[model samples]
Target: MHPSRRAVLAGTGLLPLALPLLGQAVTPVRAEPAALLRRAIPSSGETLPAIGIGTSRRYEVAPTPEAIAPLREAVLRFVALGGSVIDTAPSYGTAEDVLGLILAEPGLREKLFLCSKVGTPGREAGLAEIERSFKRMNTAMIDLVAVHNLIDTAMNLATLRDLKAGKRIRYVGVTVWRDSQFADLEAVMRRETLDFVQVNYALDDRVAAQRILPLAAERGIAVMVNVPFGRDRLLKAVQGRDLPPWTAEFDCASWPQFFLKYVLAHPAVTCPIPGMAKVAYVEDNLGAARGRMPDAALRARMETYVDAL
Candidate 1:
């Protein structure tokens, strides 16, 4: 359920303590339990927490206990603080492995709306990779599985369909992070029966917004935004600039929140899976899901503001 105005109180005690983020303890955003925004999967109507964790560069750690300790803590805190979506892939080095170990932490796996991808081509290879993903993530079933970059889209998607039909997976999706693949992504969206589509959309990168997002909504496919910050290009673009005072009209607090809120405000977006490497960052990003979202007018202003920078 999406958080309501009655739920966005100053202190609902959502975050009780400061958490370690990159070894620096910082005040986590105080959120309301009822206000933590969630969006439904158009396929199964399963709602997901709006902010998701992305294990790309962050979770590719040395699988030793010491090196994996911080990541484990972050994942636990993320779930503790009302987060559920966790996206990982086999191509992301030891990310799947790290999550496998982290999943062993009692009661964590079931709490997550876990998502992984199958990047390899061919039927057998795709099936094998999906099987290995389950082994690597230490789960018998995953909530959602996507075709990484829409790779060999036909065969891989066919495999995902079989897995879903067998109840081995709950939902099937395809991902496209590059603008060049927009044609391919949209074609699949129009042709296939999909529960979700993971794509790159952000304050700076609005190209996907032009058509892809609308298509997802029209097709009834849930949308998960990847690289909402445009891979940090948006962050670096706004560095040292004070957030426009008018931003507070919608309850936007920080630049990161601004970036994320801009994406989430779109009627079509389900969640923006930003890569939060630390516990503090995760808390900060969740703030976007708590406050009043910017309206369409504010969204236009945001684009103008960023383009001027």
Candidate 2:
């Protein structure tokens, strides 16, 4: 793992959450279909589900057969619960392979709106990586392809534009998770005609809202949110703090829902991708996509609650 990725996971104290639990059949939670928000790609008007699955650490480390079984079930549960967008990358070791295996199951391929990233810094290398991703994903065409972290982003975006025009990829976008790259990301968002932009934004991490999100809304670019729980740091912050009762107003049944709904409520955010390996966690995360989202006034109260904590 990259040191930065390790640091991101370590900062969130995810090891405990990742501990293996006895596999139990997860009962699907009955959540009414929340109001679905739709956004159009600037170049193409294709609409996408507003909540996506981030399969970074979540799918990268299942070394044992026992460990992989639950993930297969989790993927099924995710689709059953109305999840369609799944984000993965070549850099996420073994995640693309594992997702490929699960997706090969009968009726699984057509159920997903797949998104993957090219981590290589050069145009040729990035295109080669995306080709490998196509083979690993067991799909002829992918739904979305992004330049991961904007490494050689301009070159990669140019390549993506060509591929998108040829119908090899449905949407083209870019992602930046680190705070240091915000300025560059803003420049790209302003100058590039993109289908989407993946960003790090959560209730506690509102910096993106100050600029990136607004630009995306103005540019008619769909937004895919990564690290919605602040890479799990926000979960740690709320560990001891009981969820406020007013959270129930939006049918937020857990802290995950509370945090996720806050991000999903943003009109600019088309989706919030949270990574999880467990079937129960998958069901829980999908619940955030259902039910009433906090309106502006209620969103303020949520921020205040988190701030007070």
Candidate 3:
């Protein structure tokens, strides 16, 4: 049984609230459809759900029956809740193999917009890695392949471009998680005709908002936000705090939604992929996609509230 349905579940991940928007009382959101929120890929205008799931530390596990059961359940729940994108990397040990198992089952691949990365730094190594990715993912065509952290970026992007041209891959781009690497990331973004750019951005790490996000908007590149919870640091910071009552204005019902909605509220953010290890947590994370998003005013208020904390 999924823990979420075991009881009427609610969360307050140390969230803070200020005065209600225009003093409006919290209105209930009971009958909203299960539709997930979506944003457009600037390059092709194709829409993707604004929330995605990541498989990093959470997914690097041995291929035992006990280990895969919950991971499998979380994935199915993610899709059932209107999620489409699933991000992974070769560096995430055994994640690709595990994901291949899930994807090879019936209709799962068609339902997901999959993205993987080649973190190796040489031409042959990068090529070898992506080929392995193809076989491991059990897909002849990958949706997106990025040069992780821009290692040997030019070479990897070149390879991905060739693959894209051959229709072996649909999009090519790069990813970076550290602020120290943003300059190099921007340099590559400025020089390449990329389809996507993955970067870190959370309530705690808003550096991407200043340049990377705006540049993506200007370059017509889709943005995938990583580390939305500051790799769990933000969650730890807000531990035991109460959610603001006015969060309902933007349809935020829990702390996870508060963090995710903050990232999704940005126009340039296509999706924020938060990793989950449990079916119930996946359901909880997906809840962020169902409600109203914070507008500019509320976003400012949210930033201020988190900053104060």
Candidate 4:
């Protein structure tokens, strides 16, 4: 069974009353037209869909077999809808295992740009985590393995580089989710050779755009965006607001699309992974990937509209 909504909210530091009850079943609703946008990996030029899924609080808290059933279907729906990237980590409870079970099915493995992270503080621990991730993900080779939160960057990157050299992984990267780490993250971007970097950035949180984003572009490092909805905080911000008619000029059909489109508009963003347990939310999130993204003038209008709210 799924954890009580109260329990899940507590784990995520959100109040229980903010979300619907857990036992109340939610149905998966597919988007009318599956939308997809592609962005290239800086090093290999491999194109990944601009929208991806993240397994953090959503999958981490729902570790039981029955609780994960819908998640499997969601993953299948994600691929069916044209999404290619799946971002998870050893830290995210049984997320890797859940993904492994789904991907083990025929044709699903190749459909994913499988991505996971290593966050242990030492080289040995990091390597052990990598092995565990591979085992749990049921993949002999992962599309990307990132150093989570920049922990032991020097050591983990060295090991990941070795793994990449040995043909065990396709790309190696590093990530930072907190603002405090931007300095260290920028330093790593300047000094280290990496294929990608994942960071917390959203329309409401533009701090990363100041330096981290430009640095990534300048250094030819692909960027994966986390918390594009600001962990549901941004969702609450736009709750009852209708999509302004002008939002359609850039192809935004819903609030999630508006928020995601804002982030993907930046030339440097490779993908944005939004976490969702329900397939409906996944479909809604994927809609942002379709058609045209905001150009400079439209982006300015988007900023003004969001700021006025």
Top-lDDT structure, candidate number: 1
In model 4, state the lDDT of residue 303: 79
Q: Please give the ranking of all candidate structures by lDDT, highest first, separated by commas.
A: 1, 3, 4, 2
- Candidate 2 or 1, higher TM-score: 1
What lDDT score is found at residue 297 in candidate 1? 92
Candidate 3 Cα RMSD after full superposition onto the native fold (Å): 8.2
Q: For candidate 4, give the lDDT of residue 242.
A: 68
Comparing 3 with 4 on TM-score, the higher-scoring candidate is 3
lDDT of 2 by residue, 142-180 (tens): 989999998888899988888898998889899989777
Tens digit of lDDT per residue, candidate 4, span 1-309?
Answer: 223222332355522343456777555432245347899988888898999999998887455668878888888888887898989999998889888877767988988899999999888989999999999888899989999999999999999998998999989999999889999999999999989999999877889999999999999999999999887787898877667778768866678888899999999999999986787777777878887889999988877876777
**Weakest lDDT window of 10 consecutive positions for candidate 4:** 1-10
Give per-residue lDDT, candidate 1, residue 16: 36
lDDT of 2: 0.81
Which model is ahead, 1 or 4, in terms of lDDT? 1
How accurate locally, in lDDT, is each candidate?
0.87, 0.81, 0.86, 0.85
- Using all chains and alpha carbons, the TM-scores for the candidates as numbered come to 0.89, 0.85, 0.89, 0.87
Model 3 residue 295 lDDT score = 92
lDDT of 3 by residue, 175-234 (tens): 998999999989998999999999999988899989999999999999998899988987
Candidate 2 TM-score versus the reference: 0.85
Clashes of each: 0, 1, 1, 0
**247, model 1: CA deviation in Å?**
1.2
